[model samples]
Target: MSSSIPPSVKPGGHTPHDHDDAEHLKALGYASEFKRDMSAWANFSLGFTYLSPVVGVYTLFAYALATGGPPMIWSFLLVGLGQFTVALVFSEVVAQFPVAGGVYPWARRLWGRRYAWMTGWVYLVALLVTIASVVYGAGPYIASTLGFEANVNTTIMCALGLLALATVINLLGTKVLAVAAMVGFTAEIVGALAVGVWLLITHREHSLGVLFDSFGTGTGGGYLWVFAAAALIGVYQYYGFEACGDVAEEVPDPGRLIPKAMRRTIYIGGAAATFVCLALVLSVSDIPAVISGEDPDPVSTVLNDAFGATGAKVVLGIVLLSFLSCAMSLQAAASRLAYSYGRDGMIIGSALLRRFSPTRRVPPYALILAAVVPAAIVIGSKISTDAITKIISFAALGIYIGFQMVVVAALRARLKGWVPSGKYTLGRWGLPVNVAALIYGIVAIVNMAWPRTPDAPWYDNWIVALSGLVVIGAGLVYMIVHPLHDRSSGPYADAVPENRTKA
Candidate 1:
């Protein structure tokens, strides 16, 4: 019993939707275009594009500031290790059911379809809200680069322009998205390396003493908890890696390539992200200044200081590439996630939203719809960039919930001795890794949700709370609708659950 269809009278037939998926898979190159040769690199690059700078710059700064000084660097390293364990668990689920829906489908099989629909609806709500966050997150960087005036209109216009560009890029499909990510990957690596070099060469006087000694600058008492929570907020950047798995059907060799691509992405992209984290910690003279409210572009400030405005410009270019790459990557993932939802009949206009372009083999309708939601948020421009950062942080937080659910399901199977087949393996380390991922997730979520104090009205707390409400609302709607439409095979299907791999 997969997640997509509820446990009731199961309907089996050669429906048009079935034919459509098979053909859609063929047209998109998932049927053949995605050979193992390129999948690993492309997926890793995609993951890097999404995780490297977007989430990194926005929330991690809060973590560094709220936590200690350079010790924040170690927080990220800890989070990364925990996330890696979760990623491995997901890889096995993916390898078992290498379809487009990913975890929701797994939920259907293990839990039941009614539950799966509720969960998928929750995921869809998270996805749509995240679109708004991305636009909000990137707006300030573009605005602050040349140092825009006090004119709010000018800032609004500049942010709008970024949204327009990202939306357009998204319309072009994953082939274009992948190419842009590759470019982003190049810029990200080069920029981080360049920044690291400049920091070491010029800011040599800063030293480890400053890095280590700067932690106690904040108010004492529950400060350690606040700091950890804030860092968890920052760690959200590395999310969306699972997007690669969701769009597995659109790739070339899903069974052989999708899991491989996903795992390799964790390995490679994780390394790059670690470098960026380490560079920022090592480079800045004043740790608090970077993530603090002052400098909008902390890394750029370091570059500008190290090599002058020219150097800052160089880093700015990289950050822009990083943001755009992330936007493009996000657009692809969001669209694919929508398509997966449609396949499960969760969204309105499911048939239309899930339509594939006959020529390109891509989900043009879903992608187009995906762009509209985010662009509309950007158009309003009411949500501050910091607010958007919180949203992505919250999105990362939501993903952990999904991770925990899957881990519980997998662990349940393990306890029952009902082992499944898949590509990702945890060796003798499975139980320990699962426990660690759970702990890491719980810590990050608490860190993310913790308010600045008892009276603060921080956007992170608000957006996260609102997003949770949206999930609840979606579940209620899904439940009402399911009773009317269900021909259930279970309560949930892991997400249109059929097993992980078709090959």
Candidate 2:
């Protein structure tokens, strides 16, 4: 699990932990610029918070239930399994290249700079839009709980406010971000458990078998298609586990710790989300009515039915906290991505974006850029309220696109005789799992991005697919016009650690 330190940077006066971390980083061709303030728990908390069950489930719950009925709940387990496969590949990659840029860095090391740039570009956009989506999702819940009119202006303002709060937390440095994430994690767990238990005990209205019942309302290529669309909720929820890898530089012994943090984030987050979804499904009073639009907002309706306005409001408040925490983690992850790209002089204004504040040991400019793009997205979403759904879909699709690029890269690397190193390894099962992960990523991307709304305009139906193409196309154009010298092959080539031959 430990990387060999290059003789030049070997520990003399530095503590063993700091020396190990510093040398590990130096061998990877980066300075220990920021404070490695996050512990393993904080690392896991950031990932868990980024994959916030409250935000993901509550935001998309009604859509899934309406689109695919009760059976859609099973999509959580299915997507969780698929994503776990991807997580396995990512864990192995991160163990060796435990740097700031998550998918981007992994892709670059495995493939090259052009591939990494695109992965970073798609992921950066996804993370930014995700911040906007999380904040916008929080608005109505916040408004309803606080008795404010949940209008466009109010929602936009609320989103902006939350984005601002997240920005401030990121600006405060790793310790504060870690603390906020931990608090958010604790709150979400407690709140999910409290509401889930209450609902199951007092309001259970359906059999456990209901989750398998499709209710015979299949459309748009029958049950599987509807199920695929419903899987968006699960797909979105299962991601952000890589946020642990994104902030790997901030974690001590990242090669060993980050992989564990990533897996734990998925396991714990997936379980909590499933429990909540199950309780909500079993608590539904009338599934037919919910699917028929009689209860357009089944999640809120169920909460209000189980516990009066006051109780619902309390739960909504916890959900709002979850939303904010999710935004905070998204911004932090995105900023690290920016910093990573900028560090190698890959992006424009690399000097400023890569600069770490001496006092706070944070990338202030990168944080600002992260907040700015999402704030712009929020502003745009407000202009067309209907755009919120499409934007969220597109964002999730972008993330998957970036993820599969890494999966594809891993497969290519494996075929080229690459071997994984560090504490974690799939061993003989690696090829099958990698191939399965690759297949799942491709299938999921097509399923999620395929136009489900045939009646809608072409652009509306194809927003996810179109957005992904545009992002990738734009990145390509930019790269062609302003090509980057591959850092990994240049003077700054990462030193090959003596013990790191397995990679």
Candidate 3:
């Protein structure tokens, strides 16, 4: 991978490679608007920052431990293997399509405009909600670092501030975004490694045998059901790899480089997440209390105990940076998806959303939309304390559903005899991998969306599945009334060379 660098294209000057990339875009029925500036390392950094193991592990450690005991840590490996298959399928699609929007363009070129519209709609909502969730998760760390009280009001305020900050960085264009991602990736890796090693070396409270012991957790249905509920820790950590392909127009040699970046994001991010989880599990001072729900925040307890107040504060600072970087990367991906929708005239306010700032080489209005929608969602936290949790629950489910839609579309195209013709092809492995991805995606979506909180109100229990259905149903109604799919100008499945003239 090349080193992270600034935008390579200069005013009135373009490299031959840049011209070739633009020609490829033209062949796909779109003129290149974004500057091809992000290098291979920058692309990987973007996805890595979005995956952000520090952010994911820190956010959900307490909940997972409380619900499923130490054994829940294995979910990382299970979900990692499943998601790797999905990444392989996506890498091949992106290698062939290499469009601005990740799943939307892939689905559109594989199926039709209608399928792409709904898939994009669901994925866009998920990204916006995820941004809100990440920023809100950072609230406690921000409050602790700044010596402020961590309350609902404080969380909302901090989330809004973080949203605004991320929006500004995104508005500056892809170069600044890439640089920030690189910095975040570096901080996350170093901080995670240092913290994990320190905990394992100086704060080993339990032996490795604890991972096999559940500490009498789980419900009447047994540990299997509870383990599925706790799998969110791993399910949430494996995505954001697709963000590498979301900015396809900004990267050179995307057909080859983006696939490598996506695979790297999954392999490296999964390993980091597993290591961090293992370290924390081994360092927990009171596993029984955590599983029994007596101690609500094991993460804070472990950190404060291992590293004194001063050291914990330093680690909190790193956690805050991870959240900011994750939120920023989500915003970048969301804006590009929105821009792709508008560019095809498949959404409301197409002109405004598709408006590109040539100077910055970004979709400014789209960036604002991404920030504004998530900010609105953050404000909704005032309605109920569980609002953020519900949003997060749906965020993971919605992402998996959107992903499966693309997987199914790809499988359908393959059945119709369409073969991937990009530089990066799975070759004979394509069919089996695509099949495995679809099956895993389906099972994961069901596991994530299933109602498990029987003690809570019905709405809270069903929030994950309900929220996804609501979004998809709303999109269906909009598609019927506005007929945006019919008005779309983007190329469809029939336009591909494999479909029209044979591979």
Candidate 4:
């Protein structure tokens, strides 16, 4: 696949492989706008950076430890395997479609326009919220690293600054975005591995056996419920792998390479997350205090102990990069989804959103939409200290919902006799993998959205599930108000293809 496109071609330059990619897009009823500059590594880097292990583990370490104790680390393995199944299912679908806007395109090609609209709307909102959540999460670390007091005002400002930086990088073009992602991936992996190894060799405070010891943390439904709540760490770390397919047109031979990138993102990102979590878990100096809520930020507590103040600040810098990279990749994905919707005439501002920058080969209007909404979300955080958290509570669940929509659509297509015709196909294992993906996605969604916070206000407790319902409900109401017509000239414009086996 690498040999298909020559490395000598200049940025935005055309070649034989470019013509091939264009032909593929034309066959799918769309003209190519993105420059095919992202290589397999760049594509994988986008997904890996979005699924940043350092960002995920550091942000949620204290919460997971406090909620479920040491045993919560197991959720990484469980959720990793579960999400990998979803990745496999996605791999198959992306191989067949290889279209922009990952879940939305897959869902549209597999189902119909209304279904695609809802899926894209939900996923686009989720990506925007996730960008806000990531940069917001980065604020405290930024504040602490810069020797400033971490407060609501400071955090909000820091979040806005990071969001602006990420947006600028994204606006630069595909090459810049890929470079930023690759740099982020490199820094995060090196930092995580260095920290993990150092902690294991010199800062080991607990034995491997401690992983099984929950330290008596669960209440109503035994440890299982608490474990489910704690599973947010792994759940949040996994889904960004699909971002690779979000820019399917930006990579040559995406049907083959995108699936490989998705699988690699899952395998490599999962391993990095588990290693980081395991090291952090074993290095916690006061597990009992963490479980009892006395040590609120165990990641900081462990890092400060292991590396001291100066060294910890350096690690924090790396974490800040991971957060920024994650936000940038997410914004890129969101913009692509917006662009895809616009291209298909599925959204209100189709013309503006679909307008591509001739020089940059990017959807400038869509990128602005991605950045503006998330910035507004960050600004809205000033209304309440927990506003960002409430918004973020919806991010993981929203993503899971979007993912399952695609999974369900794929299964429905399969039952309707659609066979995947692509370079990569599951063949005999397709049915079982699709079924497993659906089952796992449903269970994970239920687990993620379950009202687990009993002592909090009713609304706070149900925020995750409620937020998801609100988004989906809003989309449903809009579709009903403006009942969708087959305005799109795209291949599958509100109509499933008669030949299910053809791509």
* Candidate 2 Cα RMSD after full superposition onto the native fold (Å): 4.8
Name the better of 2 and 4 by lDDT.
4
Q: For every model in order, what is the number of clashing pairs?
A: 51, 0, 0, 0
RMSD of each: 8.6, 4.8, 3.1, 3.0
Task: Provide TM-scores for the models.
Answer: 0.81, 0.93, 0.95, 0.95
List model 3 lDDT by residue over 337-455, tens digit each. 99999999998899999999989999999999999988888888899767667766778888888899999998999888878888799999999999999989988988887888789
Over 1-503, each residue of candidate 1 has an lDDT whose tens digit, in order, gives 65554443235523333344456444422342221222446766776776665346543554455356566555556666777777777776665566666666666555555655655656655665666565565566667676775244665666567666776776665666666677787887777667666667766546556545545544566556545654653467557567767666555445556666666666666666665666666666665555465655555556667778766665666677777777677677767766666665655677876677665556777777767776665555455645444444446556666666666766665554535455455667766766776677676665655555455566443666556566667678757865532653222433222432421
Model 4 misplaced regions, further than 4 Å: 1-16, 219-221, 484-486, 493-503
In angstroms, give how far residue 57 of model 2 lies from its true place.
0.9
Quantify all predictions' global Cα lDDT against the true fold. 0.61, 0.85, 0.89, 0.88
With a 3 Å backbone cut-off (N, CA, C), the pairs that clash in candidate 3 are none
Which lDDT tens digits does candidate 4 get at residues 324-392? Answer: 989999999999999999888887889999999999999999999999998888888889767777887
1 against 3, candidate with superior lDDT: 3
* TM-score of decoy 4: 0.95
Stretches of model 3 off by over 4 angstroms after superposition: 1-16, 495-503
Task: List where candidate 2 sits over 4 angstroms from the true fold.
Answer: 1-15, 219-221, 387-389, 485-503
Best-first order by lDDT? 3, 4, 2, 1
Provide the lDDT at 51 for model 1.
68
lDDT of model 2, residue 285: 91
